[model samples]
Target: MVGAPVPALRGKPITHRIPSYKLYFEYCPHGDLHDVIKAQVDEREVPVPRVRSPGGHMRVQKVRRADGRLVPRTNRTSNVPFHEGFVWRMFEALAKCAVAMERANVLHGDLCPTNILLGEHDPDRFAIWPTPKLSDFGSSRVIDAMVASRFTPPETMQMNFVPPELGVMRGDWEVDGLKVSHRTNVWQIGLVITCMMRLEFYLPETDWRTGPSSIHPNDELHFHDPNQRELHPHSFQHANCNYSPNLLALVRQCMRYDPARRPSPRALLQRIQARIPGSCGGMDTYTGDRNGSIPWNKTEKLRGLKKDNEWPLGDDAEVVDVF
Candidate 1:
C-alpha cells in the first residue's frame, strides 16, 4: 500500500544539546477540523445576515434602513444542517489516511478533530474545498498486539473521542487483554463524523461535570451500557438535514461495541468510495502549500482552546465570520 498521505515535513529535524528536537511540517491555512465544525455550528445557531453589494458580492449586513431611520440590525438562528456531500468527502479522505496507517502498522492513539488539519481550497485539483490531512503524531505508535494489550491511554488524551473499551479500562490494563488495533481508529473516526453531523463539539446529552472538568469521567461507559438510551447515538435525533441511510449505517458499523465487528480501514475506505458519485479512483491529491499563511486570528485560536464560559462573548466573537 502507498505511504500514508500525511502532511509533508518541511525541513529536517533540528537537534539541540538539551536532548530536544524540532520538526517542521506543511502549514494548513484553513486551520483544523475542529474549527470547521465549530464554524458550521456557530452559523447554524446564530446566522449572520448578508446583502448583495453593488459589485454583486455578498457582504455582512451591518445596518438596515427602517422607516427612514437606520437600525443596528437583526439576526436569527438557522436550522440548516451540514452538507451531506461535504461530509462524505471528508470521510473518504480520512479513511484513506487510516488505511495507510494500518498498512504501515502504525496506530494513532489520539485521533480527534483538533488533530486533523485542513489544506487550502484548490478547486482544480480537488472536488471538495479544504482537504483534510491527519496531523500531530505525538501520540502515534507502531502496532504491536501483545505490547498494546498492556498499554493505557495517557492522561492528556481527549476522553470524549476515546473508544468505549479504553474508557472502561480506566488505567486498569491488567484486568482485560484488550489490544489497541485499527478498530480503535474506526471508533475515533465514527465519533468525529458524529460530531460533524450533530454540529456540536461533544455528543448530545453529554454530562459535563459541574466543576472545572468539561466531560464526566464515566460518560463513555454510560453510553456503552445498553440501559442508557439517553446517551446512546441511536436515540439521539439528528437535525432536519438530508443524511442518507447508507452513510448513517456505515458510521454505526464502525462504532460497534464489539471491536471484532468493526470494519478494517481498507473496508471502510471502499464503503466511503461507493457513496461518492464518481470515485476519484483513490485518495485525492492535496495541492495546497506546505508552507502558507496562517488563517486564524487571535479570537479564533482562543475559541478553539477554551470552553464557552472561559471565553466571554464580546464584540470580537460577534463580529468575526466563520471560516
Candidate 2:
C-alpha cells in the first residue's frame, strides 16, 4: 500500500452571533493518527472478546459484525482492507511525523499502534485510495499542564504517555520529584516499536487468551532464556538496561532503564535516517526490503502509485472515507 494524500484543511473563521458575536472554526478536515489506524484496519473487536481492551474511542474498521444469532449478512460498512506491511509503513511514517512534533516542541504524549493509521491503499491513485491518517489530540497536555496534574490525577482521571514519576505518590520519592519530559516520548516510541515487532499477536486479537497482553513488561519469568526468547529478550536483566537485546539495538535505547540515557528526538531522527538512506517516495525506496515482495499488482491500482508487487495483506480490509 502507498501513502494516502495527507489529509488536512486550511483554517477558516466562522462568525457566530448569540449574546454578541464570536468566531468559531468550521468543519476542520485535519485527520488524526487514530482515524488512520481504523480505516484500513485488519482487526475487529467482539463484544464477548476475552483479552483485548475496547478500541480507541475513535471508530474502528467494520466487518460482519456479530449479534446473538451467529448468522452472516451481505451488507458492509466503509472500513477498508489493509495489508500488514502497511502497519510497518505506518510506524515509519509516525516516526517521521514525531520528528515534526519535536521540531515544534510537542511530544505526542501518546504513541501507540492505535495512534498510527493503517488505511487501505491503491497504487493507480495513491492520493485517492482511502488512506489512514494519524489522529487524536485530546490527551495532549503541554509541559505546563503536566506541572499541575503531576499532583496525582483525581480519582476519575487517567494519564497517557505519562510516566509513574509524574504522578502524586504516598511517599517522598526522588523520581517523583522529576516531571514528565521529552525523553518520556522516546520511551513511548519504544512501546510502539515493540508492538510493531509483535504485530502478529496484537493486530487481530484472535489469540488474546495466550496473547502478548498476558505478559507484563516487568514479568521476568516470561523473559527467562529458556521460557521464551521468541517473544522478547532477557536484556532487562542487564544492569542499567531493561529492554530486549535481540531486536534493533536503538529501540532498546529508546527503552533505556534510565531516562537520562535515552536519545533525544533529534538523535532518534538521525538514527532513523541512517537506517533507511533514501526511503521516501516510490517503490525505489524498497527494492530489497521485506515490503518489496508483496503481490500488489494483482489488484491494487491507485491513481499514481508506483507499480510493484509489494503489499503484504490482500484486500481483506475496506478503505473508507468515513471520519
Candidate 3:
C-alpha cells in the first residue's frame, strides 16, 4: 500500500503524524459553509497523539484523502435544471467565500464552475442545501494591488468567465488601481450565477441543427459570457424569463464594465440576505415582508444531480487517481 512513509536522518523513522482531514478542518473553521464534513481524522482502537516535528532543513507539502464524499461538476447531468432555491444557495456559498477571502487579504484568482465543489446534505447536522465549497486555491495570491496590476492572467482561465478589463487590455486604458479588487471576484461570482440561470432555460439536444427547440451553434452552456459577444437573437428571449428580476439585476451589476461600479462581496451578501432571509445564515424575521420580495424555496429542486464527465477524483478535478 502507498502512503506517507516516516523519514529520518538517523535511528528509527520519526513520524510527525497529522490527519489529512484535521489539516483542512483547521485551515477552514467554517468548513460546513462549503459543505465540508467535520470528519475524524484518526479513529483507531488506540488513538494517536500529536507529535512535534524535529528541526529539518527541508519541508514538503503532501496531499491525502479524506472520509467525506463530494459532488464533482462532471457528475452533473443537463437533463434537469437547478431550481431557484438551490441556485440561491450556491450563490450564497460563492459570495460568502469571496467576502471571506477579501477580508483575509487573499484573492481566488481563478473562479469557475469546476473549482466549485458541491456537498450533499448532512441529515445529522441539519444542512439542507447542497452546499458549494470554493476549492483549488492554486492560483490564489495575497491581496496586493501593485502585484495584481502586473499580473498577466493565466490563459487557461475560462474565457467566458474572465472579466473584460483583465481579458482585453487596451493601450489607452486608464489605471484605476482596482483592477483585481473585490469587484473582480464579484464578476466571477456573477458569471457562475448567469450560467446557472442559463442552465434553467437549456434546450435538449436533437438531431436537427436548425429548429425552434434545437441547440443553437453558439449556445455555450458551460460558462456565462462576460464579454457579451455576438449573442444569438433568441438569447434574450429567455432574459429574466425564469430568473427573478432582482437576481437578474444583481448578476448584471456584478458584470458591469467598470470595476468601481461593482458592489463589494460583503455588500452582495447583504443584498441577498435582504432579498432572501436565511439564504446565507441571516434571520428569517423578514420572510413575510413582501413589497416585490421573492422568497427562496427551501425545498429540494435539483434533478439529474449526477456527474456528466469522468475527470480526476480530487484537487481541481485535474489529475486522475492512480491508486
Q: So what's the TM-score on candidate 3?
A: 0.52
Instruction: For each candidate in the order shown, give its overall lDDT on alpha carbons.
Output: 0.61, 0.41, 0.49
| Highest-lDDT candidate | 1
TM-score of each: 0.68, 0.47, 0.52
* Candidate 3 per-residue lDDT over residues 9-104, each given as its tens digit: 123333447422212211111232211111111121221222345774433333233755442212212223344555666676678887888888
**Candidate 1 residue 236 C-alpha distance from true site, Å:** 6.3
Model 2: runs farther than 4 Å from truth? 1-11, 14-88, 118-133, 145-175, 200-213, 216-247, 277-323
The candidate that wins on TM-score is 1
Residue range with the least summed lDDT across 10 consecutive positions in model 1:
293-302
Candidate 2 local Cα displacement, residue 253, angstroms: 1.5
- Comparing 1 with 3 on lDDT, the higher-scoring candidate is 1
Worst ten-residue run, lDDT, model 3? 1-10
Off by over 4 Å in 3: 1-79, 122-127, 151-156, 168-178, 200-241, 278-299, 306-323
* Tens digit per residue, CA lDDT, model 1, 50-129: 67999999765556575676553555543335556567767877898889888888777678888887764545434335
A best-first ranking of the candidates according to their TM-score comes to 1, 3, 2
